[model samples]
Each structure stands twice: as structure tokens, then as C-alpha cells.
Target chain A: MRAVAALCLVIGLAVPALGWAQEDKPAEFPEKLEIGISTDEIAISSDFRGADLTIFGAIEGYDPSLLAQSKYDIVVALEGPKDNNTVRVKERIFGIWVNRRSMTFELVPESYSLSSTRDVETIAAPPVLNGVGVGIQHIRLSPVGYLGDGSNLTEFRDAFRRLKESGGFYQRDPGGVQFISASLFKATVKLPANVPNGTHVVRAHLFRDGVFIAEKALPLRVMKTGIEQMISNAAYNQSFAYGAFSVMLAVLTGWLASVVFRKD
Target chain B: MNIFIILGMGAAVGFLSGMFGVGGGFLITPLLIFYNIPPVVAVATGANQVVASSISGALSHFRRGTLDVKLGTVLLVGGLAGATVGIWIFSLLRSLGQLDLVISLLYVVLLGTVGTLMLLESIRALRRAAANQPVSLRRPGQHNWVHRLPLKMRFKKSKIYLSVIPVVGLGFGIGILTSIMGVGGGFIMVPAMIYLLRIPTNVVVGTSLFQIIFVTAYTTVVQATTNYSVDIVLAFILMVAGVIGAQYGVRVGQKLRGEQLRALLALLVLAVGARLAVDLVVTPEDIYSIVSEGVYR
Candidate 1:
């Protein structure tokens, strides 16, 4: 009877300890995404061509099993300044192509550069990506005005994406994101030659087994440097003065040329 | 935006303008459009370019004692008012997303009509020269409906009592063209002054140049203020190349016959207009285009 009691106690203690060890609770903090860029602002010179930007990041509290199985996916996007964009479609009218219909999408990014661990679509379902607005094809483009039947919505949206992609404004790199370590990641995005000068947002998203788990965003400013930027700034900020100066400069140039090339 | 290409375009247009004695604004705007510059930028910068190109000609006219200040002032009154109205129209069309279409259409029509008329006139002159026929000269003091108009004013330089109604009306028309088409309007203004208004031959070119300088300068300032499309770097490169080319053009022009120069210019204008028209009719590779509003300040 004493041996049986001892066996029961041992089994009870051992079972609970085994259960506790097996059912390991997730870290106190959920998986979090942290991203860092070397510089907060990029100064574009007058002769600036396209540039590649590298972002380093880390996934905190990530499960080792998921990381080893490559079940984790990372997507990093650099979104340019947002503004209302209008897409116009030209149709044949009287044997001439003319812009007959237009749709304005409210607060759309001027440029977008996306990098992902794998194809964003293969990583997650379309609905999920659309909900997160993570992929170029999934970005939300809500029309500002009234719609009659919403039939043309898809057509216009597709056109907007197609044009943006062709113009090199919207870009995607399926294999641009790679894991440097167990939880550390590196993502590279492109800055187009004609990148708009404004505050941009670098968004990092982490997915575990096709499910979004974490997101982090950092702000970056793109500034133009040199004479071109100064002129552009003057044109926008002090418009009237700039206008007057343009006229004065033209006058001076004209006067100087006339004096230099005087026939008399 | 290849600087060398832009310089070449400017120099080419400048040479032609010097040879033909006209502002290169009309040619420059179309060429910029062909080079893929936005129509808005091309138009505004073209106006700025005109301000420079017209200055030298106007200065030379002023020095030659040919400019009639009082007559030009009367014209200026109408030009300034016309430019204001034209700007309003320009902005309205821009908002409607029809500015490029309208500009292209206007260029086609204007270039077509002007080219046809100049070609025919030059051909006739050439034929007359071949037949050894004396050129028929219109009497300067001939009376017409323009002369009969009210508000006749006397100008000592032109030595004619011209009606202010026709003078101001002509300036008003040219002013609108200057703002919208980015032309100095000298090609149209010169013929109108001599044939329509019966201004003295000596004073006609000078008077038109005087009006052009002010109107184009005003257009430049207004376009810069409103559109913010005037590219100073682009304008500077064009102006420098243009002025230098004009000097050489003037020398070559002295050796060319007026009839041949006019005919050549007319052909060039017609060809450009035809190219623009073809672009309008041709099916674009992509039927869709996007314009980002208020994205760039």
C-alpha cells in the first residue's frame, strides 16, 4: 500500500511537470518587427539617378520552429508621398484618341517599392494581402467620386497599377528580402530616378505561416539638393518673386545678347 | 531630358526664327512636346524663352528709330487684358484634363492655316519672279473698313491717323495667342499691321516687336506664377544656345532669298503640324495615363 502511494505521487508530479514542459507558452511579448534605415533623409543631387536603399530589420519573439521551416515571410515597402491621383483612359472619338473617362483615386502613393521574402501572393492569399494592402497589386485605390455600378472599378484599378508599374513608379522584388540570421532580415528597395521629393514611409510587415503577425513603419524624407532644388523651391514657395525674377533674368539675357551681337 | 538634345532643338529653332525674322516660340514648344516634356511645362517655358528671343529684336528696332511708343502703348492696353482672360481659360482647361488636347489641336489648326497661306504666298512670289513680273504693291494710304473704324489716333512715328479700335483689336488677338500658343505673334502681327491696319512699313516691324516684348514678358511672369512649370535650367540652356545660333542664322539669312526662306519655313511648319496630327490619330501603345495632382510642389 505504501509503494502504490509512492508510485501515484511520482506519476502525478511527473505528468504535471512533463505537461508544463511540453506546453511552452509563447514569449510574454508577441512577435514584433523592428526596422532601421541608416539615414532618415536622402539628399538627391541634381544628377541623381536611381538608387538602391537597404533596410535592416529584426523579428523579436519569433518562434524558432517557424523560422527554421521558413514559414515566416517578410515584406518591406517604401511608399512615396501620397496625393490624389487621376487616371484617364483614352477612347476613339471621331477617329482621334481622346481622354474620355477619368477616375481619381484618393490619397494614393506617388511611388511604391516593395520587397518580399518570396512572391507576396504565394506567401499569403489574395484576400489577406488585399486587406493588409501590402502588395502592389493589392494596394487599395478607392475612388473619390460617385460610381454608377462599380463595374469599371476593376478596370480602372488594373490600369492604374499597370501604368504605375510600366512607368517604374510601382516596383516589386519577390526575393529582395532575405534572413541574415535566425530573426534578423535585410530588405532592399529601389528609389526611382524621378522619385518625388517628400516624406516617404518604410513599412515592414511580418507574416507567420501566411498570417500577418507584426508591422512596423518608419518615416523617411527625400530632399533634393543643389541649384535645381533651390529653383524648384523658389518656384513653389516664393512664386510671385520667382516669376518676377524669371522675367528680370530673361530681360538681362536678352539685353546682354543684343549688346554683344550688335551689328551697328 | 538630354541637355544636348534640348540645345540642338533650341539652336535649330533659333536659326530658323532668325532666318525668317520670327520668334522661335512656336517651334520650341512643339519640339519639347515631341521630346516627352509635359505640355504644361513646354508651354510656360516657351513663353519664358520668347521673352529672351524677342528682346534683342525689339532693342534693335527701338535703336533704329522705328518703334512707335504711343501706338505700342495703345496696343499694350488691350494685350494685357487679353492675356489675363487667356490665363483663366488655360487653367480651366488644365483642371478639366483637356489642356494637352486643346493645345495640340490649336497648334495643328494654327500651324496648318499659317503654313498653307505662307506656302501659297511664297509660291506665287517665286512664280512671279520666274516670269519676271513686277510685284504688285498695295498702296499704304488705302482706305478700308479698319481705317473707317472710330477712335482714330495720330502717331508721329507711323505718320498715319490709325483708328485705335483696329490697333487695339489686333493686339488683343495676338496677346491671346502669345499666352496660349507661346508665340510672340509677330508672324501674324506683322502682316496684320501692314495690310490690315495700314501701318507705315518702317514702323510696322518695330511696333510689333515693342508690343511682343511686353506681352511675352508679361506672359512669362504670369505663367511662372500660375503653372510653376517654367524650368529655369531648361530655359537657360535654350536661351543661350538660341541667342548664339541666331547670330549665325542672321548671317546666313542675309544670303538667302526672302521667297526661299519663307517657303522653307512654311514647309517645316507644315511638317511639324502633320506629325502632331498623326500622333493624335495614331492608337497609343497604352490607352491609359495617370497624372498625379499636387504631388510635386
Candidate 2:
């Protein structure tokens, strides 16, 4: 009977822990979600600290009604390991939620519907950080709204340049090509220093008017290289030590209080 | 070795919080940065830990019949409104990408001014005490501008006759600063209560903590839901330790001479202020990118 009681007590405590563990898993992806990051593996040189990230993902299935009413926004985040679990810390580097008309594209020349024209709204530039070196830089490209008929490439490039000048998108080289066909578009940008090391997510959204038409999220891994990795690992692993330090301080404070306030 | 150092740092912060009645962000933020934690994470985590400490401390004070609920409520109402406006302002600056420089400059100026004032006042108080004279503390005059304001009210604990407008205005200002800086604003609130509102010393301690509880709690929840900035696990651990430490601190506080305590606190504040001032004047190690991305974007 004693052993059984002890066993029951242990089981009760374990139940909540198990439940929490299960709940900690990443949120389940929607059934038709299509996600992909710009790169699978990023290599950093000893001199390398951070880089600009381009996240591109697409979504296919859409309900026209949902796309017409709700304001659609996509959030890309970075998650890292903490105490044996992954935790999300940063938020959307690329937010694609704007009025649908501003982002909409048109198929030019009704008979030549073989290619669609997309007005790629300006991409926002990633945040710049100071010394200590290393972190993720992000650039996002997403369609603004449902494409209509008669969209032109010149109009698309104008919009893209507008975004760049407005400081929402990264400033590309003067002769840089901004327009790409959906089938053969591939571009790689370098990452800079001050980028954080972690698992990063990139997201995209298709909006109509002000409503969301489709959304996609993708993950990219950013790891430390050479000396930086060792430093980061050492720093992160200090949490347990900090916890223990706090407890000791509590004990000391309690003892001090007892001594000082004691009635002589 | 790393574990020991981290624990030591945590204990140091807990002790300072207990002794000074501060939320410990002034200490914790620099330490987190020293440990190479990202600036955003440091601020968010510090705010989270503050919630736990304030909540636990507030409950204990409430049980002791020291908390002035009516005053706390009014302050909280104003604080909430101020926080909302402050958050909006922060978002606007962020969208403009000018938030980092602004916040950094603000921190340097605010901390230096407050710290200097505290140090000077404590020195004056100490000198008076040393001469074996009863300190002649200045009382707010009846003809003072604050009293001239409309809609005056009475606070039984603080035993002051002051206008609700001033109280609310003070709360609103403090709330906005707290929200923007991720600070509890106790360092500012306590002084405001004692000097401006003319609240008694004993009442100020409990009342300030009372107001902080609500303000920090609201900040924690808002940041969690909107920004997803609160780290519950890290906060819980610090708070649990803080609670026990605060309990003992209160006991110790009761025994210490008030003047001496003030002097010690003044010295500590001045030290922190000097360090922050240096940071502003000296070229920073890194000057770009103080704002972090969150769900708000």
C-alpha cells in the first residue's frame, strides 16, 4: 500500500509534465501549406557574422470569399533552443499585408495568358544592429492582391523601386533585375554580420484588396561558425547557472533578514 | 564555472531588487547584454521577471493592509491609457526605423538626471541627520500650482490633499515611459509620490509597489499577447526567487534607520546613473539597430 501510494504521487506529477511536453510541439501546419526557405544550409566564414535573408514560400488552395474580406498578414519568426525546447523570439521580418489593389497584378494581352504579370510590392529591409557581430538580415517578396487583366512589367518595376526608395525593401544594385517569371526566378543574396544564430522562418502571403488570399511559412537554420559557435553555446548554457545563483541569493537574503530583524 | 557565475549574477540582481524596491531592470539589462543575450530578448525577459516580482510583492503588501486600493486603481487606469499610447508611439517610431537612437538617448538622459537628484538629496538628508537636527522636509504649499488644479481629492493613507488631475497626469506620464522602456517606473513613481503628492514614507513604499504590480502586470500580458515577448519560464524562475527575497527584505527594511537606508539607496542610484551616462557619451560598441521585430509588424 505504501509503495502504491508513492507510485501514484509520482504519476500525478508526471502527468502535467507530459501534457506540457506535448503542448510544446510546434503548431501543426495547415493541410495545403507549401513552404520553402531561400537556402537549406548557410555557410559562414570566420570573418562572417550575419547575412541578408530572402524567404519565399507560396500557397495554392484558396477560398475566394475569405480572400475578399479578411486582412491577410504573414509573419516570419526565428526560434532557438532554450532548456531543451525550441522557443520563438523574433517576429515578422516580411509582413505582406497591405491593400489588395496596391499589390495586385494583371495578365497582359488576354490571348497570351500563358504568362501572368505580378506587381511585387516593395520588400522591407532587415534591421541593422551594432557591434558584437552577427545576425539574420531579411528581404521579403510577396504579391499584394489578386491579379486582374492588363498588368505591365514596367508598372511592376516602378512599384518595386518605390518600395526600395521608401526604405521598405533592400536597396539593390543600380542595374539589378527586379522582375522574374514564376517558373525561372532564382536569386541569392549575401548574409552580413550581426545576424543571430537560430532556426529562422520565412513567410509569404497573397492578398486581395485588403483580405488574405493565401499564406506560406518556411524555416531556415542559422548556426554559428568557428569561434562564434563556441561563444554562443557557452553563453546560452549559462541559464541553469543563473537559476542556481538566484536561489542562493534568496537563501542569503532570508538569512540576513532573520538576523537583522531578530528581537534581542 | 559558468553556472556559478550566472547564479551569482542572478543572486546579485535579486538582492538589489529586495534591498532597493526596484524591479531590477537597470541591473539585469546590462548583465544580459554582457552575457551576449540579444537586446530585445533582454528587455522582454526583464519585463517578464518584473511582473513576477511585483505580483508577489504586491500580494504580500496587500495582506499586510498597507496597499491603498483606491489610489492604486486610479493610477492603474491612467497607466493603462498611457501605456496604450506609448506602445502606439513606439510602433510608429519602429515603422520609421528611428526608434533605436531615440530610446538610447532617452535612457541616458533620464537615468542621469534622476540619479543625480537622488544622490544630492540623500547627501543633504544625511548632513541634517548628522547635525542631530530633525530634518525639515518641505511640504507642498497650499498656493502651489498642483493644489490650484481643479477636482481635488483626499487620500487617507497618504494624508494629502491633492488634485486627481495631477495624480492621473503623473501616472499617465510614468506609464508611457514604462511601456516604451520596458521599465517598472518605480524609481520615478516613488519620488513623485513622496515629493509631488507629499505621501508619507511608509505609505509610499507599499503604494508604489501596489501601482507597479498593476502596471507591470498589464505590460507583461500586453507584450505577451501582442508582441509575444514575455518568456514565462525565465520570468517564473526569477520571480519565485524574488518573492522569497522580498519577504526578507521587508523584514530587514523595518529594522534599518530610514535616513541611512535613503543614503545607501542614493549612492547606488548615482553609481548606476554614472555608468549609463558614460555609455551615452562614449562611442557605443554598436550603434545601429536597437528595435527588435515582433508580432506587431
Candidate 3:
């Protein structure tokens, strides 16, 4: 009985220690990967059935070279989980440029896939630059130039339309991944007025040879304003409610002060 | 304008709101209008700045133990309800497509009347003070009707006996107006507390601020969720400047006599009123439509 009790105690402690030990082991990347994007969440899974490698872990950090390097392959596939469950994927061998100040992404590459999904719209691939191979698709990525040269309203509108058409811009949609083709340009995505005020997930993925090598998800939060726009409309647009209230208060106070202190 | 310029304007309005007890709506809305921002967007954005400035002021007042929790709570409860109703009314008007013209006309009339009244009152006070006449005092029996109302209660700060029903009714009414008008409602509440409730001047400021904090905070949360109008970045920048300015204003406010402060505030109101009056008579440079595509639209 004493031996059995000692054995049970040893097993109990050993089980937890074994768990700790296993947890300390480093993770490995899988050979094949499937990435999914939904309205609320993002999921990345490795294809164990077809691959020998294992995904050890996922890390996210600022990479300035992401927009410039073309030696490795990077592809982003967006699969919707609701309703139609449509799948759209884009693959490219590109360099990356990171705007550290503005947290922007720019992709530069000698070639890029114009259409990765069967049904989704695609942009016409730009011609490859000199010295780069002429065969595949080439896209220049510059965050600053992605928008345009000027802050004029027309320029801004055109830039927005182009970015939407290019399928390489960061936009708040039902779901999608932002990819870049060249490191030559830079742009900023201004938050639209219609965006819901709440927390959102921003995922950055690194791919090579049609598979994700690394993926990272960051958290973004939106906050509230204290007054309703309708109230403002009523006050400023409809009736000087703020001014009227101020005057009423001033008059009441002035009258009361005169009466109480007998100053008038 | 550029992002930096927008941010700078927000900071400037926030500082002014902190320095003066008045809400920055008068300044911010006009400035935005002048800059060609739609009235709705201007009001919404200005409210965002007001929340920041009021928060900074409220926190300091709370720290000083000047805030009256009970009074503020009553006011907030009524105010929030009223604001909801006001928003509904505003939407109704908007759907009818007459919101802008109505609002502008109201602004003109209200400002003109208020400004003229204040100027005249201040002059009268000055003349009376110079004549060495005895100041008017409230008759002991004057507030008998207030006592007759249901839910009678005593507010120690204001040191007057009044019914809770009147207080709440006044709060709700003012709240509705405030929500409809997009004003802080501080101006209304201060007077109600002083004359109707007979609260003392010292307690009035703190109590009004307490109620404003709750009302504005609610406004911010609701506006953000429903309309996504709140910009955290903008609010943060304005609050930093506003809090610093508020501290200085409070010190300066403490040194001035109540009569002097009232007179100055009256003059400021009148000046703003006159400006609005002029805007009413003179045709707007741009009388374009105020509609825009956004979540609300």
C-alpha cells in the first residue's frame, strides 16, 4: 500500500512536470498552411496531411524589409466563413516596406498573381521593371505613393478608388488581407466615418512558396464621444440649445444674485 | 485642413472651454462651419472635444470635494432620458429635410434675445449698484408653491426647501432641450439650481459640473457606438491641454468676486449672442446642404 501511494504521488507531480517540459519545447512551422479571415476573427491552420513540417509558433513584429524582398514567396488567402463561405487567395513573391511611423505596409515584387480567387475581382498586373524578369506579374509597393501626390479632394478620391481597385490596400471590409507588391511607394489609410467603434484584429502574414511561414495578429481599439450627433444637430443646426441654455442660466443666476445679495 | 491643423483647432477650443465656464460649442461649431465642415459633423466633433474638456474639469472638481453626487445623479437621470427623446425628435426633423434652416433661425433668435437681455441686465445692475439702493431679497413665503409639490426635499448646498418633482421635471425638460440643441445644458441647470431650487452660488458650479460629467460621458458612449463619432486620438489631445488650462482657470476663478465674474460672463455671452445675430441677418457665404454619407445616413 505504501509503495502504491508513493507511486500515485510521483505520477501526480510527474504529470504536471511533463506538461511544463513539453510546453518549453520550441514550435516548428508546417509545410502547408490554410489561413482564414472572418468578420470577427482570423484562424490559421497547418495541413498535417500533406506536410512534413510543423508550425511551432507565430510571432508578429515590424519588418521594414517586408516590402522589398522578392526571393521568398508570400501569399494571403481570405476565406469567408459565413453565408457563401467564398475563398479568395492572392500569392506573390515580393519585397516589403514598413512605414514604422505610420504603421503602413508596402509590397514590392518583380511578379505577382493578378487573380488568385476564382470569383473575386482582380487588378491588371503591372509590367515588370527593367532587369526584373518579364514573364511573371510585377507590382510596385509604396505606402506614400499608393494614395497619390497631392491632398486635393479629387486626388484623394482617385487614390481611394485606385487602392480599392488594386486589391492591395488596407480597407475595413467584411474581411480581407492587405498585401503589397513593390517597395517603391507608401500610403496611409484614414479611418472612415462609418467604421464601428470597437476593438478589431489586424493580422500580418508572411508567406513563402504559397504557404504562410509566419502570421501575427494585433489588437486595435476604438472609443466613444460623450454627446450624440443628433443633439448637436438640434442645438447647432436646429436651435441654439447650447446658447439658449447658457443665456437662461445667466439670466436666472443674475436675477437670483441680485435678489439674494440685494446688489441691484 | 491637414491633420495637424485639425488637432490644433481641437486643442485651442478645449483650452477656451476650460478657461471659461461656458461650453466650447459656441466657438467650435462656428469655427467648423467657417471651415466648411457640415453642421452635423461640426456639432458631433465639437461635442467630442467638450467631453474631454468637461472630464478634465470634473475630475479636478471631484478631487476638491465640490461635486454633489445626489443632485448630479438626479439631473443625469433626467437629462439622459431627455436626450434620447431629443435625438428622436432631431431625426424626425432630419427625415423631413428642414433641420438646417430651422436650426440656423433658432440660433439667431436665441442668441439675439439672450445677448440683448444680458447686456441690458448687466447695465441695470451697474446702475443699481451705483445708486446705493438696498439689494432685493427673496420673501420668506415666495417659495411656498415649490414646497407644495410632491417629493419635497432639502438640498444642503443650495440651502433651500424645494420639491424633488420640480427638480426632476426641470432636469428632464432641460435635458430634452439640451439633447435637441447639442448644448451642455450647464447654463440651464445652473440657473434652475440657483433660482428654482435656491442653491447657493458656490455649490451651483460643482453640482452643475457633476451632472455635466455624467451627461457628457453618456453622450460620448452613445454617440461612439451608434454613430462612431468619437475620435479617441482627438479627445486625448484636447483633454491634455484642457486639464492644464482648467487648473489655471480654477485658480483665477477663485480670486475673482462672484459679482465680477457674473458680469464678465454676461458680457461674453452677449458678445457671442451678437455674433450669432449678425450671422442671422447676413446671408451665409455658403448655404449649401448639410447632408453627408455616414453611418447615420
Q: Write the per-residue lDDT of candidate 1 for residues B1-297, one digit (tens) a residue.
A: 799999999899888888778888889999999999888888888888888888898888888899999999998888888887887788888877888898899999989999999999999999999999999987878788887788888999888887898888888888888888788888888888888888888988888888888898888788878878777788888888888888889999999899998998999999999999999999999989888887346
Better of 1 and 2 by DockQ: 1
Better of 2 and 3 by lDDT: 2
* Candidate 1 vs 3: which has more TM-score: 1
lDDT head-to-head 1 vs 2, winner: 1
Q: Runs in model 2 with CA error above 4 Å?
A: A1-264, B1-6, B140-143, B154-161, B247-267, B280-297
Would candidate 1 be rated incorrect, acceptable, medium or high by CAPRI criteria?
Answer: medium
In angstroms, give how far residue B54 of model 3 lies from its true place: 2.9
lDDT of 3 by residue, B134-205 (tens): 778764335646667877666664565567777777667766655445456676677767777666666677
lDDT tens per residue, model 1, A28-93: 436666677767888888777788888887776678887899989999999999999999999999
Ranking by lDDT: 1, 2, 3
What is the C-alpha DockQ of each candidate? 0.57, 0.03, 0.02
The candidate that achieves the highest DockQ relative to the unseen native structure: 1
What candidate 3 gets wrong by more than 4 Å, as runs, is A1-264, B2-20, B60-65, B128-141, B154-161, B231-237, B250-268, B277-297
- Model 3, A140-207: lDDT tens digits are 22343335443443332333324433433223221122233231111112233332334543322344
Of 2 and 3, which scores higher on DockQ?
Answer: 2
Better of 1 and 2 by TM-score: 1
lDDT of 3 at A68: 44
* lDDT score at residue B211, model 2, on the 0-100 scale: 68
